[model samples]
Target: MIAARKSLDGLSAGLMLILCACWGMQQVAIKIAAPGVGTILQTGVRSLIAALLVAALMLLRGTAFFGRDATLWPGVAAGLLFALEFLCVAVGLNHTTASHMVVFLYTAPIFTVLGLHWLVPGEHLRLGQWLGILIAFGGIGLAFSAGFEEHGSTSTLIGDGLGILAGVLWAATTILIRRSSLSEAAPTKTLLYQLGVSALVVLPLAAAMGQFGAVSMTPVIWASMVFQSVVVTFASYLAWFWILRRYLASRVSVFSFLTPLFGVGFGVLLLNETVGVRFATGAALVLGGIVLVNVKRSPQPVPV
Candidate 1:
């Protein structure tokens, strides 16, 4: 049994790492796809595809897509928040560079930590945690400042602002999931709710923006969409929710610091974006802060 548990632990860690990589690559994929498709259309199609993938997975796993005990309103709310998050992110990408957007989006964790503290008592951060958050936020400021200096434009500022809003929405969604009764819902079902909701919200907006006509039936676009929908959104999200269910939220949330790191690296490689000193310095501080916030201390035993 002990050996089995050890193997399971190792497998979970491996899965988490893969999820992290996929998530990192996902930012790059979306950035690549942005040129061919309008942001809203990209988000709508991705959500629709992800919803379908999750549905297929549920079928294969013999799991129901709808939960018996889950409240419809909570699911709907979660889905709405998810949609807003994606919408903001997609639109922000159009205005800002991927490197800038990625760093700003990571501010979600900071929001999550704050929201959890208020919504879920006993989840509050200590002084050390607050210091860590400040450090991480400073990193975010640094990244933004670097981007602004590199591309001094009104549109870039707008994009950066949108990116920050997206982070807030992302954090709100996380809090909703953590605090809502929907926490008991099956992972597949919850994912479907989020994806389906986003698709519903964005599809009409994309149509209104005349993005449907902009979509080309190219192999590259199709490939990017498939990766975003099936692999990153569906698979990684399912795994993320599963991890949230099984572990402490703080513990799992801390690993998200890797997203920006991966995002910057991919931006350099795929988008040929130059990494500046400010970006490096800020990312280091942010990641260091996240580590400081999440470090676990050994428990002291009580005297019998």
Candidate 2:
């Protein structure tokens, strides 16, 4: 049996930070490797690699693959959404800065909350949550406006829009999982559906898009592939689920806000992308709004 979960501790906090950093660095990895391996093909290949690992793990654990859980269709839909999300990531990176991609993608929570409010009972938006939605969208508008500035280009704006669409798709996947039979399935099972299906879908799509011809495997490309497949996609996801099983998910999730910050930092440091003050302010608002929307009200502890 699983042990009872506890409040966040120092070790868990530290690990969460590490996980966030790893996730934040994923776009940077993709961008770095894109020159050698076309972005879409690279993403598809990594998904394939990670799917194999997940399948092996499931096999070792004796997890049933063809269970009659009535989740197959939903699982496939989730996988499609997952594929489309990364497709946007792969293509969008070609047009936008990694910093922008990270910020826009993390907006998934906002969209998820909105979706749940309509679909799930008792998931009504609170006043603060509404305010947060307003602020977050306002920030998105402000950030998008940066495209109109002299330094911004049409491609960057398109990439930003794709980033937002990716976030929306991500949110749709989350909602489907929560509302479908997949909610009761094992985490590994859910992951397999996503990874396996994404691999199947994305690889062919990449080929159709003629992205496979750019495969020049340098050490950097190989390293990026290994990191994306092993560390970011495989290990970090498992670690996150492990953390959720052991700690208060609410407390742990709050730390995710740091991911965009880390992404922005990595972009500036590694890619030398410049962030104007307008974009910075917009990002801050988006982060603040996300925190406001997600942070739940907890009753204070009474004196003994």
Candidate 3:
């Protein structure tokens, strides 16, 4: 049993790492498609496609997609938060540098820690964790300062702010998932709620933003949309929720640090963006802080 448990833990860690890598690549994919598609259109198409693919997968796997309990409300709330997060990201990307936007989006973990402390009474960060959060936030500030100096536009600043807002929304969604009765629901049903709510929310917003007409039938655009929907958004999220349901959220969340690192690397490789000392230094600090925040220490028993 010990060996089997160890193996399962190793596999779970591996899966989480892959998920992070894929998420990192997703930033690159979005950047690639951004030039051709409006942000709203990109988000809407990706959500729509992902929802369809997830529906299909559920059908194939014989898993019931809808939750049968009061948890449904929390699931719906999570989905709304997911939609809001993406909407902010999409609109914000239009106004900001991709590098800056990526960095700002990582602030989600900070928000997560804060939210968890407030909503989940038993979970609290130690002083060391608080220090780590500060260090990580400082790193984010440094990255923002450097990126803003190099590529700052007014629109970019707006987008960067939006990205931060998106992170807050994401954190809220996570906290809701943990604190609400939805914690006991099936992962698939929970995920389906998130996607469905996001799709519903984004469709009208995208349409109102005049992104509908911007949609093209081009093979490249379609391919990017489909990949974002099926691979990154749908499959990746399914795997993520599955892990979250089975594992500790804090430990799993630490892997998110890799997303921005991968985003920076991909930006350099694919978009030909410059990778400088500032970016590297900031990234190291951010990743280090993430590690510090995530490391678990044994809690002391209360005095009898």
**lDDT (Cα) of model 1:** 0.76
RMSD of every candidate to native, in Å, equals 4.6, 5.0, 4.2
For candidate 3, lDDT tens digit of each residue in 40-156? Answer: 777777787777777777798897765457877787789889998988888887777667777778778777877766665445667887887777777767655756786677777
Q: What is the lDDT of every predicted structure here?
A: 0.76, 0.76, 0.73
Candidate with better lDDT, 2 vs 3 = 2
By summed lDDT, the worst window of 10 consecutive residues in model 1 runs over 1-10
**lDDT (10s digit) by residue, model 1, range 1-304:** 0100011244555676688678777767887877788878988998998998888888999987655675578889999999998888888888887777777787788778778777764456678878887887787677558556878689988888888898899888877886776666788888999999999999999999999888765787778888888888888899988876655555466557667778777778887877678878887897787677766653222111
What TM-score against the true fold does each predicted structure earn? 0.88, 0.81, 0.87
Give candidate 2 regions above 4 Å deviation. Answer: 1-16, 132-151, 239-255, 274-291, 294-304
User: By how many angstroms RMSD does model 1 differ from the true structure?
Assistant: 4.6
Worst 10 residues of 2 by lDDT: 295-304
Runs of candidate 1 with Cα error greater than 4 angstroms are: 1-16, 298-304
Which lDDT tens digits does candidate 2 get at residues 141-173?
A: 575465446437788888888988998998788
Strongest candidate by TM-score: 1
Ranking by lDDT: 1, 2, 3
